[model samples]
Target: MLSGAALSRFRKNLMGWFAEYQRDLPWRRTRDPYRVWLSEIMLQQTRVAAAIPYYERFLERFPGVEALARAPQEEVLRLWAGLGYYSRARNLAEAAQEIVAKHNGVFPSEPADALALPGIGAYTAAAILSIVYQKKLAVLDGNVARVIARLYAVRGDLRANGTWQKLQATAGHLLAGRSPGDWNQAMMELGATLCTPRSPQCLLCPVSEFCEARKQGLTDLIPVKRSKRSTVELTLASLVLLDPRGQTLLLAPPAPARKSAAANDVHTLVSRMWHFPSVAVLQGQAAEALRKFAEESLFRGRGFRLEFFALKKVRHAVTFRAITIFPFRARVAKLPRVSASKAFPLADLSTVAVSNLTRKVARAALALN
Candidate 1:
């Protein structure tokens, strides 16, 4: 805990650093709540460089809360396709609708009110209130938390409830400037750029003198992270069926579940998007398992005969799961009468929304032709 005078000095030094070194991000350009909300949501679990283009494009399509509320779910999902986390896009659209109905298309200024909206957590609420409303509130995100932990040498389980409270209280204590938004961003920026998780740049840090971790030679160990779960490796086998006319088969979402447990699991992963019918299977029996899956779920007594040949393997990962997708190219003589599969020209994949894994499957299948 810094004394009042020491805290004041810290704030002045941090603010000075921010003035000289803060990167120009689009979200920093305006105090508009909508743009701030959009950028914040897009930045979740995504890097700044990756989120910028998507942020610009999303705003261009849905300029305001009313526009986002009126846009179809598919259209929003299409724009957010390659962004990975589909749940964030869904919540963004849902929150827009809630704002239009509940707040009359205006963003809430109060942190409490802002938190009531879907997907708006404490950090987001604080950021919005401080940045947009200029409230003297502190922001405690991952970066800020790490910075705070190191500055105070706050060890032990940070995920513990009491530990987090201490961190938040300390953050509030240090937020001394008149412009809380700039101060909060400055702390986070320092963490992101200088106090990185691995090999922090303490020499260039503006407030290194105050960092207990640096003084104690424990910068790398101050902010303890929660242990990750064991990685699960899976072998996914997918059938790339093409009709005699040569359009590749793709199943639309809400596709009925298959009997195979492996296929059902993969189907759940992509419950709301289009993809080739795929199943996780034993490496030794991948071809036979996919053939059985295609016959039962994809063909469905439509007299469509699947003649498939196994393609090269495509590797991909989703968080803790590492997957190697084995694609099999098949020729179909007839179309399914009861299946949800639709044939699309391989050249027109960009026109529709799909997962990154599905794109890899498409690429692997196309290479065969």
Candidate 2:
């Protein structure tokens, strides 16, 4: 509830500090709405360091909204392969199509219009509008929320909608009219670098004088979150089918069991992309089941002399399961007709969206070939 000159002074001090010490990130170098939108989407559940390379690769492949809209869905998914949350990639493609059709291929300038785009919510819309367009809007992402909660010593479950609304209101009131972009960036920077979740460096904070948590010795406890749901485990068995010609096999994920009237559908992992034929295996049987399944499902039906090659393991965390993927490679006597696709080269391993585990197997198989 800062007001009058106090809010102005707070913003001035924060922005001044930001000018001196903001991190040099790739996204900060451009004001292009397309680039901002891409970075924001890629960073939804990913860290900055990981998102940077993906962002660069995506931009290089599809440089603009029109290019993204015209690109094949498979290509888009391939660019977004390792980055999980496949729905984000789908939404990104849909949004690009919308921008091209409805907005003449130009990104919407207003925050509300940006929010209307697929996969964009209030925080993303606000960020794009403020940072790219320099609009006088407050952006309250997780980082900003934590920073604001700690600064004002707001004590409640931040996950609660009421608590979030109150914090957003406070943030809106604090934004300086002249420098909304800098104010937003400063708040996010402070949260990310200084007001970290554990052992916050409050002593080095720019506006320590205005932080209630700093004054009251509650820097570590003000921004509280409810405990998350327990993670559920799942086991997957992935197959790498190789022919005598050294070509591998891939399958597209099946369509939804049912489609809504509006055509909105829920998609599974690796949806709309090229992936190795895989099955969910029972825990502890991943190794054996994969070998047997590959022999029966692939080789016996096609009459190929299958030789079990190397087995490579990959550990990745999905929403719940700490997935331990065991990739088993087998070389067959001949290539199956189902293994051919115009979109991907079964002979070339680099063109498909294989899981990280499968990628490891493919690389090993290539080296051995």
Candidate 3:
């Protein structure tokens, strides 16, 4: 419970430190609500360095809400290829379309309006309203959560609803009225750079003097995390079905189950990009199973010579599945029309939204070709 001159001192110290030490990210260069909103959405569940290229590419393509609204979903997904969490891309496009229709192509300045946008939650809404619109809203993200938990030496599981309420109240109390945007960014910057999860640089922290966890010599242990669940390993045989001309097949992922809407839709992963026909390997020999699945699913009973040219193995980590992908490539002498349409020339692999595992397979296949 920070109060009086102590709270003021804390805010001053944090903001001053942020002004000097904050990283000069591209997203921080603009005060445009649309740009800020896009960056915030992209950065969710994504690293800053990784998000930069995607952000730049997306902005270059869409430029504004109207452009984003009009752009095709496939193009948006292609731009968001390497960045996981495909639903963000989908929802962002939907939200953009809605903004264009409802708000005259302008992002709403109010937090509640921003919150109404698809995939825009409390943190995102606060961030956009504060930073872009300069609204007096407090933004609480993972970084702020860690910062608050450590500062107050909060001992409860952070996932608990009560803990979140407490954290929100604490964050709201600490926000400075004049520069709420700077204050919010400052807190996030501090947590990202100095108050890190594993080995926090307490000596360099701006508000070290006020941090209860540091004073109590519990900086490492203050923000307790919920226990992690075990991951399920899945073996996937990814067929890199390439025609003689070098095109690949791709399928749209099926809609997610009602209960697991947040989880990655495997159907979308395959459907969104051009890749060799693939199948899940439940049991039996890998090569035989892959060939049989391709014949039935991809070839569709068409008679085309199956040439097993290259086999490459790649591993990818999804939220719940540790997937091992085995990529197999074969070139047919009489390239079927079906293969020709589905296949992409081995040279233009970057144009598609293939998964990292499939990308690895493509690289290997290209080298072999």
Candidate 4:
């Protein structure tokens, strides 16, 4: 708990640091609720540096809420190609349309209305209202959570009820009587820059004097995390089917059985893009896995004397599982008589939407060809 005098001094020092040191991000220049909402969505599960180019390009293409609302979801996903997390792109567009329908293309000023939108959650609603509308609501993103946790020496599982409640109280208490835009940005900026999760620069921190963790030498241990999910190993085998014209065969995903967080990850696997048959396989059965996948994917049914090439492995991480992917390439001498929908020429890959994971897989396999 911060005393009245201590909180005032802390906020003063933090905002001073932010005023001089905050990065001039493109989104920071505008108070447009649309842009703020877009940035917040993109920044979720994505790094700031990577999100910048996407943000700028998306804004150029979509321009505003009305523009985004008018654009097709395919174009939006194409513009969002290689960014992964395709649901965010889809949901962002849905939310824009909702805003247009509900608020005449303007973002809602009320937190409840914003939260009612398709992808806008509590944190995002708070951020949009606070940063753009200057509503005095505390933003409790991962960055702000870390800053608050360390400043007050919060410990235990951050997800635990008591710890989470304490952090919320600390954030609200610290946010009292401050400009929501400046204060929220200051807390986040401090966390992103100085008060980082690992090896925080205590001496350089603007509010180091007020940080309980720094004074107690517990900076590294202050924001203790709950036990991590155990890392599981998964081996995935994909059969790459190619035509005589050097076009790669791609297919749309089958409908998933149900919707869950894990289902969302699978959505990222082949959302609106061309992809080969991908499936998890048991260990040490790479050959059998490829054969089964090839059979199921019409690679064998095409009757084109396919020759297989064992390309290099592509590895990717998702939550607890580290997937080691083995891609096998097969070529058909003659093209199939029937035309396909989503297949594209390998050379013209740039013209089509491709997931970042697919790009990574292609980089490893295409080099072999």
Give the lDDT of residue 237 in candidate 3: 71
Poorest stretch of ten by lDDT in candidate 3: 255-264
Better of 1 and 2 by lDDT: 1
- What C-alpha lDDT do the candidate models reach, one value each? 0.82, 0.74, 0.78, 0.77
Better of 2 and 4 by lDDT: 4
* Residue-pair clashes, model 4: 0
CA RMSD of each candidate after superposition: 2.8, 3.8, 2.6, 2.5
lDDT for position 193 in model 3 = 88
Steric clash count of candidate 3: 11
| Model 4 RMSD in angstroms | 2.5
Best by lDDT: 1
Name the regions of candidate 1 deviating beyond 4 angstroms: 244-246, 255-264, 302-304, 333-335
For all candidates, the clash counts are: 0, 0, 11, 0
What is candidate 1's local distance difference test score?
Answer: 0.82
Ranking by TM-score: 1, 3, 4, 2
Encode model 4's per-residue lDDT on 218-274: one tens digit a residue: 898978856787887767777666777787766654343435345324344455455
- How far residue 86's Cα lies from its native spot in candidate 1, in Å, is 0.9
Question: Between which residue pairs do clashes occur in model 1?
Answer: none
Which tens-of-lDDT digit does each residue in 1-369 have in candidate 1? Answer: 888778777888888999999999999999898999898889888999999999999989998889999988778888898888777887889899999998889889877779999889988888878888888889888898899989889888786878888788878888865888888889889988999998999998889888899999998787876888887887889877776776777887663244423423775555357888887788788988987887787665556455678888998877677888888888767545446667777656776767788888888877886
